[model samples]
Structures are given as structure tokens and as C-alpha cells.
Target: MNKTKNIAVLGGDARYLEMVKNMSKSDDIHIELVGFDQLNQGFTGAKQIDLDDLELSKLDAVILPIPGTDGLGYIETVFSDKNLQVTKEWFKKLSKHCLVFSGIANDYLINSVNEAGLSLIPLMERNDVAIYNSIPTVEGTIMIAIQNTDFTIHSSNVIVLGLGRVGMSVASKFAGLGADVHVGSRSKEDIARATEMGVTAFHMNELSAYTSQCNILINTVPALVVTNDVIKTMQSNALIIDLASKPGGTDFDYAEKRGIKALHSLGLPGIVAPKTAGEILGTVVEQIMYEQDLGEE
Candidate 1:
């Protein structure tokens, strides 16, 4: 038997606008847009409603924005001025087997979902989403480096910290542009992968050693790898693009104190290419829904 799935999209940017459009194409999926009252564009097959108007007991799922929460329950809303917040109490009201989707999850969200006995899917943890997001991330990194530096990327010393999905793309793209690309990593397999990609690979412990000669230092590691000690060794004219999550990995305070241009670039895909980023998320969400039988054809 076919069943209708009710999903609420709560507090998000332009990407969620496109996601709603994509998800609503399935007639069996009914979407409610909350905290988007100020958005001028009308969502087809979706209704815009205030969060207070939602009947939590009837909802089958909830979709949160990529940035999700700020380690608190406050959601990011660009379209409205309303203060939108969600907590474990709200999650507990949802129907059984309800699914919650977000680009990423913080401690508060993780705890809330666990306590509610609901499933929380952090979509960014998926390999496909990470790799897809890497394209826009690399482009944005190059753009930032170019904008901040007086020298061209070609033949410049570029050191990429980490060899994760995004890090690998950043390294290869820069290497293809004739830059002297060097990748730092703790994983032996990642180091070998960087070497196989024809870029210089070094241990992360040797990061400070390369900073002095590096013209553009890109850190993708989500930890405090670029501390004051590391930034102190970097050239004053160098550019630092930290692609890690919130608060980033770079010591922005010390980098500024040293006069090095450091930028903590987050949500690069949404910033550089919103439609594509949104569609990638939409595709994945649709796939997950179909696989889980959350909705029927």
C-alpha cells in the first residue's frame, strides 16, 4: 500500500529552497516549509507555514539545513527574522520511525535524536556528498587564494593540509594549475595517494617546515592543526584558506596578528554554487527516502 510522507523543512538558506522543489516532485511526499515566511519565491507542491503551526505528532520526518545547529538547537534561517529553535522535546513528539536529516549533526542534535529514539542521518558523512561538495570547495579555495594573494597560482608553493576527500581535490586541482602542490597527512595510505597523484606528500608533523616557503596554505583538517606555532612559521605574504568546519582549524587570531591572510571558508558549495549543491543534497535525500521506504510509489 502507498503511504503519504509528511516532512517539515525547518530553517535553512537558498539550498533548502531548491531541496523543497526537488522533494516535492514526488506526489507521495508532502513538504512544509517553516521559518521561510520572508522568502518571495513560492514553493510548488509545498506549503509555507510557521513552525508554531506544525502538528509535530503527524510529521513523518524533519529536514534540517546543512549547517544544522550551532551546537545548540538554534537553526539557521536567512529568510525570516523569527527565532527558530528545536530541542529533544520537539523530537519526542514526532511519529515513531520518523527520520531526521541534516548536512551535519552537533552534540545537541545527536543527543536529542538519540533521546527521542529517532534516526538522525548526517548526510555530509556520506562519501558521495563529501566528494560532491569537494568540487565547489576547491573552486572557492582557489578563488580565495587568488583574491588574497598578489602572485598567480602557477608555479607558486601551495601546501595543502590533510588528504581527505576535499583535501585530495584541492591538491590535485592546484597541481593541475602548475602550482608546486604539497600535501600533508598522518595516514600512510593518504600520503601514498597524494604521491600517486604526482604531488609532493609529507607527514603532518612536517607542516611547519613547509609553511615558510608556502605561498598558499590550505587546511582541510577539522582540528587545530594550524596553531600559533604553525602560523608563526608561515610567510607574512602567504594566504591561508581553512576549509574545516566552524571555528576552522587555523588560528585566525595569531594569523591576523602576524599579518597573514587567513580565511575560514565554510559552506563553500552553498556559497559558490547553491543550485548544484542543493540538487546534490536533493538527489541523496530522495534516494535515501526511496531506499528506506519512507514513501511509496
Candidate 2:
């Protein structure tokens, strides 16, 4: 009872191209490439389809780009001839039992999918994929800290916000490089876990007092975790790198006004390291496809 899956890959960049290559190489998949004509001429054997004229009712699954939508139901397509947009109405049409997968899907996109009665899954939220992908994310964060700052990571006071996969990895990497790493987390077990790793750990409650002395500040918390008031304690030249999704933790306006360097770092995978990033994505997509086939029985 092994069912073959037909994937409609829409409007992705090199990552999508890599995914298609990986999928095609796999025996379980039959991917229908939609909007490949608009891409840089390299994906061999991928059939092109007019994305604007795509029929949602035709595919077993739809794969979208990471950060699926910017809370507007608009999908950014790098593989399309023209600007391709996926509206809320399109989600409605796609609601007919198609499993939608993306790296990171937002609230509006989720709402649209739910409204359309379709299943939407974000790969970044998938535990197995997310944790593994965090390896690149952590490596990227380390690379940025190395590139952006004049000071070496060794002996630098580094404050990493939120003890999630990225935060923990960042903290561990910095610590391994002989930096004094401090992790900001909310949960007791997370704090304990950070302490166990020989790093200074604090709950969000204690973030204010110890945050200012750091030479590097990396925020992984996906919200407005760093405010203007907190920014006051930070040194003028301190580098604040926010890795959150949208409206990130750092107050960019305030940081700029105060002469502090604040950066909202996004798409690290594609930018800092695309090949490794593509492999990370390819691994996950295969798992999903595997699970998908199992579910068909």
C-alpha cells in the first residue's frame, strides 16, 4: 500500500531547486515543478507550469518557501516568470485535503489554510527538522558574530536570549570558543539545562540586570523580548543580532537612534550557507514524504 506522492513545488529559490533534485532522486516522489521557467536556467527535467493558472485541486501536496507568508497570505516565488501571489481565496480552494508544508508558516497563513480547511505544517516547527536545522542556524550565528565584530569570540561576554535550539547552540558554540556565554530563558528546566552546560543562565526575570555588560547580544526569542528600556543598559557599540521571525526582539528604531548596531538577521540558511542549508531542508522534506506515504495506508 505504498502510495506515490506528487509534489507541486511553487516559487522557491535554490533551496527549492535542491529539494526538487533530492525529491526526483528519491524513488517515493513524483514532483510536478510549477514555475521553473522563471528560475535561473539550471534545474534539469523539471516541467514548468504557469503558477498563476495553477489548479489547487490537482496536487497531493504543496510545498512553499520558508517564512511561508508574511502574515498576508502572499507567497514569494523566486521560480516564477511573474510575481506569484497566493491569496486567501486560493487557500480556500486548496482546503480540499491537501497537506501544505513550508519551513516557517505564520498566523495569517495558518488562518487562511484553516479557513480553507486545508492542513498546513511548518517545517521549522517540526521537532526533528527544526533541531537538526538549528545546527546551520547556530553556525550562521557564530559566523556573523565573527564577521561583524572586531573582537574575538574567546573571552567576549555573549548574551543569548531564549534557550531554544538556536539559542542553546549559539551559547554552546560561543562557550566552546572560550567566550563567557549567558542564556536568557523562561523555564526552570531550560535554565537548569543551560547551567548544566557550564554557562551562566537566567530566567527572563533576571535578563535586565545582567544583559548590559555583554559584548555580543544574540536574541532568539520570537517576540519583542528586547525593548528600549533594556537597550539603555547595553553599551553603545554592542552588536545586537535578532534572529526572530518578524518585528524581532530588538527595538531597531531605538537602537539606531541610540547609535547601537542592531540587526534583524533572517534567511541565514540561504544567505550565509545555501548548500548546507539546502541539504538540511532536503532531509526534512524526505521525512515528511516518508511519513506521508505511511499515512496513505
Candidate 3:
């Protein structure tokens, strides 16, 4: 009989629940699950471990949530009074043979893992995977806009900041529905590509001048590209949907003071399309594991 690989799951939302379900289907894996007991009530054959009882050192792999274990070394779990924390120091107690994986990597986690000589894999850092993730993000953005707005997308003027994967996907998605899309990008190739796709593209030159004409503004750029000057130019009813990370691009204070609606919609794919996101992570993690085994051989 083949020995099943032991994997440990920490805290997360519904996306994590779906991930566990997908992993359960793999014949070569046996999960020592934590933080999801009630969710797996009907699922048989998997062992449940208490928050403080299980020995992490014995596991072959430890899986963390997307945006993984923040700077404070805290684990954002849904269970255990929502107070149970998992840190890199705690991770240091794990066996040397064990591997660690998360959706993202931060400085403190990187330092601690390196000090402990542990391998840490970031699943979302892969552009190939992020590109696949962007499809759901685009769809979710459209859903949010439709739900919030009274007007139709047809003939609406939409401005998209940044032409990266999510931006490209979003621009194309809005354009597909007959909305006039204008993309803000620094790259000539991307601008040319946007033009070829039948959407108006703009370089950094005079971006604020165009801001007032937009009915909807979507920002995919992670930086603070949308300053007070830009926000001041927006129409009173124009919606600002920032898809960037936390503390996103736009000036929320200004938006609120002006009574313009500004929303920071982070982790759209996970919230709106969790099953697809989980499958993407599972597939990538499987590939990483397979490649690592091959390297060992």
C-alpha cells in the first residue's frame, strides 16, 4: 500500500474550505486538517486536530491562506475564537523535511523561513497563474459595477488604470460589452495592443484631463497613481473601483468628502469565484510538488 502524504491546512475563508475539498480528492494525500472541522462534518476519512494539540513538525507540508500569514506572523483563521495565530516562529518548530506554501510572501516571513532553512513557495506570484486568476477578477468587477450602477454598460465611458494582467482582462471585458474603454498605461506595446483591441489608450501625458469624462474608473495599478489631483477631476457620480492591494490607489478621504463613491475591491477572485481560485492553487501546488520530487530524484 502506498503511504499518503500528510498536509496541514491553517485558517482561511470559504476559498480555503473549497481547497480542502479539492485536496481530499487526491488519492496520494492525507490531510490533518485544522480550522475547518464543522465544514468537513459530512466528509469521512480525514482526521481532525485541535488548535493546540497537533504537532506541526510531523507534517510533510503546511498550506496557508492567500495573502499568507501577514507581517505580524499572525494567521487569519475563521475558527478557534478567531484568535489562534500561526507565525514564522511557530513554523520554525516544524520538521526540516516539511515544506511551506502560501498565496503570497512578506518580509518577516521570508526572514524567518530563511533563518530556519525552510523552503517557502508563493502560489500567486506566478504570472501564468495570476493571468488565469484575472479572468474571474474581470467577471467579478463587472458584476459589482452592474449591481451598484443604475445605468447600463452600453456606451458608458470607462477608464482603466494600468494594463497588467487584471487591467488587460478588465479592459477587454468592459470593451466586449459595448462600453467605450480608455486604458492608462506606460508601455507603448500595451497601448498599441489596446488600440488594436478597439479601445482608446492613453499614456501618462495629461491623464487628469481625461478623468472628468469617465463614468467609471478601475485601477489595477498597485501604486498610488491616482492622487488627489486626479480624484478632484472625477464626476460626482463616477464610480472608482480600485482592484489593487490594501490601502489602494485612490484618495478615499477626498472621494467621501466629495460624495463620490469609491470602492476598494481586493481579493475579488477569491470572494466571487472561489472554486475556480482553489482549483488554480491546487493545480499549481501539485505542479510545484511534482517538480520538487523530480529534483529530489
Top-lDDT candidate index: 1
Clashes of each: 0, 0, 0
lDDT tens string, model 2, 10-112? 7677777777776677665667766567565554435667766666776668888876867666667665646566788877776375788887777788888
Query: How many collisions between residues are there in candidate 2?
Result: 0
**1 versus 3: better lDDT goes to:** 1
Which residue pairs in candidate 1 collide?
A: none
Worst 10 residues of 3 by lDDT: 37-46
Task: Return the clash pairs for model 3, or none.
Answer: none
Model 1 regions lying over 4 Å from their true place? 70-72, 294-297
Report the C-alpha lDDT of model 3 over 69-104, residue by residue, as the tens digit.
777877777744455567657877888767888888
lDDT of 1 by residue, 13-108 (tens): 888877888878887889899998898888667999988889998887799988788766999998999889897798898877788999898899
Model 3 ranges with Cα > 4 A deviation: 1-3, 38-45, 87-89
TM-scores, one per candidate: 0.92, 0.88, 0.92
Between prediction 1 and prediction 2, the one with superior TM-score is 1
Clashes of 3: 0
When 1 and 2 are scored with lDDT, the better candidate is 1
Model 1 scores a C-alpha lDDT of 0.88
